[model samples]
Each structure stands twice: as C-alpha cells, then as structure tokens.
Target: TLNKKLIEKSEELKQLSNDLSSANENLIIKDRQKDDFLDSVAHELRTPITAIRSAGEILADDDDIPLDIKREFLNNIITESDRLSEIINDILYLDKLQHGEIALNIHENNIIETYKKALSPILHLIQQKNIHISEVDLLNQYIFEYDEARMIQLFHNILGNALKFTDEQGTIQTKLSEKNDFLIIKVFNTGKNIPEEDLEMIFDKFYQSKNQNIIKPIGSGLGLAISKRLVEAHSGNIKAENSGLGVTFTITLPKKIINNNEVEQ
Candidate 1:
C-alpha cells in the first residue's frame, strides 16, 4: 500500500511538472506574439506618416513648384493622412474588442435584414464594380438572435474584403441556409484565390495576402481580425475557404445568443 501511494504521488508530480512546462511554453509564445504585433503596428503607421511628412516638407520648402504638381503632392498628403487615421481607428477598435471592452446587445432580429443593412456602407462601390450578389431570397424567413450592430459590422468586413479583391464586373454572392441548429452565411467573391497558407492567417492583425491581383487598396488589414472577434463574441465561427474560382467566408451562428439578464425573462 505504501509503494502504491508513493508511485501515485510521483506520477502526479510528473504531470504537474509537464503542465507547468506547457504553460511556460504558451507564455513564451504569447510574448513573442506581443513583440510581433508591436512591430507590425509601428510599420503599418510609419508608411502613411512618412508619405504625409515628405509631401508636407516638399510643399513647404518649394515656392516655385508647378501648381499641378503641388496639387498632386497635397492630394498625396490628404490620402496618406486618411490612411493613417484608418489604421489608428482600426487598432483602437481591435484593442477594445480583444480586451472585452465592447458589450454585445444581443436581441432577436432578421438575419436577412442585417445582411442587407451591411451592404449600405459599400453599396456605391459594389454598384460601381457591378458585383452580383445572390441568395437574398434564401435569407427571407430566417430569424435569429444576435447583436444587430455587431452583426452588421461582421458582414461588412466580410463583404468589404470580397469587394476589395474582386475586379470590376466580377461576381459576389451570399448563400444563406439552415443546417441542424445553426445558420450559415457564406459570402463568395470571384477573384484571385488567396494562397493556401494565407487563408488561415487572413484573420490575423495586419496580415494581408500577397496575391492581390485585382486591386491594391490601402486597407488596415484589421477588418477580418475584428470580424473574427465579433463572431466569437456571439458564440459563432467564421472561416475562409477557397471555393470554385474565388474565396468564400462562411459564418455559422447558433439560433440563440441570449444575454444573462434576458435569460431571466
């Protein structure tokens, strides 16, 4: 009996030691990720800041520059300044999300309406691109519980990404359907397929795929990260898959995401 107890204790200690080692490894990984994020943020901000400063310096130091060329530099300054502001806003927003600083106002809403509402922000560009969006008829009667504002934002990121990579007159489609207890929303865009390795990292902060054959927009690259956080907040999952001739983002959400207080009601 004494030997058995001693062996048991020894096994427990070994397990504890393994757990500690695993945890230390995780901490090291987290530390490395923090350093990498800081570096990425600095580089993301510096590009725009440098352009703006250079344009400003040239405009300030030159009195005899051509009016047209001067106007071009001024436009460059404005564009870069806008890009800088976007990066900051996206970073702050992502931080709030990661820190659980944003609360979800979950409620019963029409999934169809929410998806359509998301397009309002980028409808002009979509129309200009002539991207065809199908499957609206399928979302007709599916009602689900979610945070409407956040859901709209989630859809916006997925759709905006689709638009960004899609060429003019390229196609975009949304396939909405029900399976078991979850509602799936898949946004498909016809364009260059994301590299296999990049498909997984597309949701990482400041990570953009190298293959952008159609368009090169000054994007903050935090949209998908924010979208992922928002989906997780609602107890859902979002994934990117290369399907057909383009890439598709599929989001699956449960039928209910009731708040604690609402649960009482």
Candidate 2:
C-alpha cells in the first residue's frame, strides 16, 4: 500500500511540472507580444514627431527662405501634427476597445447612411485622385442594429484603404446584399492586387503590404487590425481576397442578434 501511494504522488508531481512548464511558455509569449506592441507604438509616434520637429526647425532657422517654401514647411508641420494626433487617438481607442472600457450604442441604423458617413472623411482624397465610384444594393430597405460610430470606423478604414491603393482615375465598386440571415458588404478597388500569402495577415496589427505604390498619409498600420476587432465585437466577420485586377474587402454581419445582450451577440 505504501508503494502504491508513492507512485500516485510521483504521477501528480510530474503532471504539475508539465502544467508549470506550459504556464511559463504562455507567459513568455505574452511578454514578447507586449514588447512588439510597444515597439510599434514607439515607431509610429516617432515618425510624425520627427517630421514635425524637422519642419519646425526649418521654419525657425531659415529667415531667408522663400515665401512659398516657408508656406510648404508650415503645411508639413501642420500635416505631421495632425498625423501624430490621429495615431495617439487610435492607440487610445484601441486600448479602450480591447479592455472593454467603451460601451457600444447599438440601434437600428440605415446601412447607406452609415456608408456615406464613413466616406465623408475621405471624400477629398477621392476627388483629388479622380477615382470613380460605383455601388450596388439589393436590399430594398437596408437596416441593421449596430454601433453606429464603430461601424462608421470599420467602413472608413476599409474604404480608406480602397481609395489609397486604387490608381488615379481607378474605380471602386461597392456592393451590399442580404442572404442567409447575414448582411454582406463588399468593396473592390482596381489597382494592385495583394500577394496571395499576405491576405491572411492583412488584418494583423502593424502589418502592411510591401507592394503598394501609393503616396498617401503615414499611418500607424492599426486601421485594419482595429476594424477586425470591431467586426468581431459585433458578431461579424471581415476578410479580403484578390479580385482579378485588385483586392476586395468583404464584411458579413448577422441580420439579427438572438438575445443582443452579449458583446459579440
């Protein structure tokens, strides 16, 4: 009997050792992730700050600079400052979303109205590029219950990407439909198609495609990652695919939440 009790204790100790090992491994992974996130934040912040500082230095040190050049330097300072502000806001918003500190204002909202609101922010860029837009909606009266502001953010990020990558005078096509108890939104832009391997990583934080050739705003590379989180928070799905000439972003949301009490419901 003593020998049997000793064997049982030995097994329990071995199991405990294995569990401890797994816990240590998890802790290491989390630590590495934290480091990566902080590094990205630092890099994003430093870029704009450095630009702003350089621009400000030029304006302050060069009294003989031409008026046009001075104006350009001032514009650069303003633009870089705004970029810095946006990155900080995005970081704060993402933290709140991840920590469940922000409450969603879910209500019945018109899909078209939401899309328009999201596009408003980027309309100037669209016009400057002369990008053509087309839309198709099969749902007669498209309405869904969602957080209006968050949904606008979700669309804004995706639409911004579409406008960013599409060539001058290129076309952006959007489609909305309802099927199988889900509301689907698809955005396709004509320009460069994303590499096959990068499709899966497109929504990852700090992930950016190396092939894009567009000149646009400097970004923190958190837009798509945040959009993915927002979609998941609403019990929805977001994905991208190569559409013959370019790439298409597709979002799917449930038509109705069963209980509508859970965060993802």
Candidate 3:
C-alpha cells in the first residue's frame, strides 16, 4: 500500500511539471511578441522625428537659402511634426481602448451622414488623386445606435485606405444593405488587389500587406487594426477581401428595435 501511494504521487508530480513547462513556453512566445510590437512603435516614432529634425536643421543653418526654399523646408517641418503627433495620438488611443479605458457614447445616427463627415477631412487627398466616388447607396435612411465619432473613424480609415490604393481617376464604390438584424457596409476600390496571404492578417496590429503597390508613405500600419477594435467594441465585425478588380472591406453591425422611443444596443 505504501509503495502504490508513492507511485501515484510521482505521477501527479510529472503531470504538474508538464503543465508548467507548457505555460513557460507560452510566456516566452508572448514576450517575444511584445518585444516586436515595441520595436515597431519605436521605429514608427523615430521616422517622423528624424524627418522633422532634418528639416528644422536645414531651415536653421542655411541662411543663404532662397526664401521659397526656406518656406518649403518650414512646411516640411510642420507637416512631419503633425504626422508625429498623429502617430502618438493613435497609439495612445488604441492602448486605452484595448485596456477598456474608453467608453462608447452610443446613439442612433445615420451612416451616410457619418460617412460624409469622415470624407470631408480627407477631401484634399481624394482630389489630389483625381479619384471619383460613384454610386453611394443611400444609407441615410438606415438608422443605428452606435458611437458616432468612432463610426466615423472606422469609415475614415477604410475609405482612406481605398483612396490610397485606387489609381488616379479610379472609382471607389460604397454600398449598404440590411439583412435580418445586421447592417452591412461594403467599400470597394478599383486598383491592385491585396495578396492572398495578407488578407488573413490585414487587421492585425502593425501588419502591413506584402503587396507593395498600395503601401502609402505615411501609414503606420495601425489604422485597420484600430478600426477592427473599434468595430468589435460596438458588437460588430469587419473584414477585408481581395476582389477581381481590387479589395473590398465589409463591416456588419447588429441592429435591434425596441419601443418606438428607444433602440436596443
């Protein structure tokens, strides 16, 4: 009886040892992932900082430079500084949202109006690209309870990406439809499609598509990641697909109607 009890105890100890080993392995993997994320953030910050510093130095040291050239350098410094601030703000906002520190102010709003608000901020870029937005399905009639600002950010990021990738004089199409209790929004741009492998990880943080043609110079590769988090926070889903003509991003949000005076979230 004593010998049998000792064997059982030894077996239990071996199982515990295996579990601890597995846990340690998992910790190692997560630690490496954290390190990689930090490294990317550092690089993103450093790029703009370096640009700003260089531009400032040129403006300060070149006393004999032409007035027009000096003005251009000053503009470059200001633009780079603004870019740096944007990156920092985005990173901080994402960190807060991930930690559940941000609260949603959900309300019933029209999707089309919100989309227009988002588009207004980037109209200059759109004009520069000579892109035409065609056939916007009337979404103003569809009312949904959600955080208006966050929804605008979501559409802004998606539309911005579409604008970045679509060729000059290309077309970007938006469509919205409701099926059962879900509202679906799709944005399609006519240009090079994303690589098949990237479609799977496109929403991942700091994940940049291997398709080089669409990568813009100023992107920190965090916009889609932030957009995905914001959508999920509102009990919705977002996805991307590579169509024959280009890429399409789709968002689905749940809809519920209660009494005439109220809407369920």
Task: Give the runs in model 3 whose Cα sits over 4 Å from its true position.
Answer: 1-22, 256-265
- Estimate, for each residue in 123-227, the C-alpha lDDT of model 3 and write its tens digit: 888889889887566734888888888889998999988987898999888889999888999999999888888887888777765666656547766898889
In model 1, the worst 10-residue window by lDDT is: 256-265
Query: Could you give candidate 1's per-residue lDDT for residues 40-126 as a string of tens digits?
Result: 899999999999999999999989999999999999998988888989999998898887778788788998888889988899989
Tens digits of per-residue lDDT, candidate 2, 1-265, equal 9999999999999999999999999999999989988887888889988989998888889899999999898898888888888888888877776776666778898988989899887989998999998888734678888888888999899998888788899999989988888999999999887788789988876765666663434676789888988888777899999889888999999876543433442
Say which candidate scores most in TM-score: 1
Superposed on all Cα atoms, the candidates' RMSDs to the truth, in angstroms, are: 3.2, 2.8, 4.1
Better of 1 and 2 by lDDT: 1
The local distance difference test score of each candidate is: 0.85, 0.84, 0.82
Candidate 2 lDDT trough over 10 residues, lowest sum: 256-265
List ranges where model 2 is wrong by over 4 Å.
1-16, 210-217, 258-265
What order do candidates take by lDDT, descending? 1, 2, 3
Ranking by TM-score: 1, 2, 3
TM-score of 2: 0.88
Candidate 1 RMSD to the real structure: 3.2
TM-score of each: 0.90, 0.88, 0.87
lDDT of 3: 0.82
List the candidate 1 regions with Cα displacement exceeding 4 Å. 136-139, 210-217, 258-265
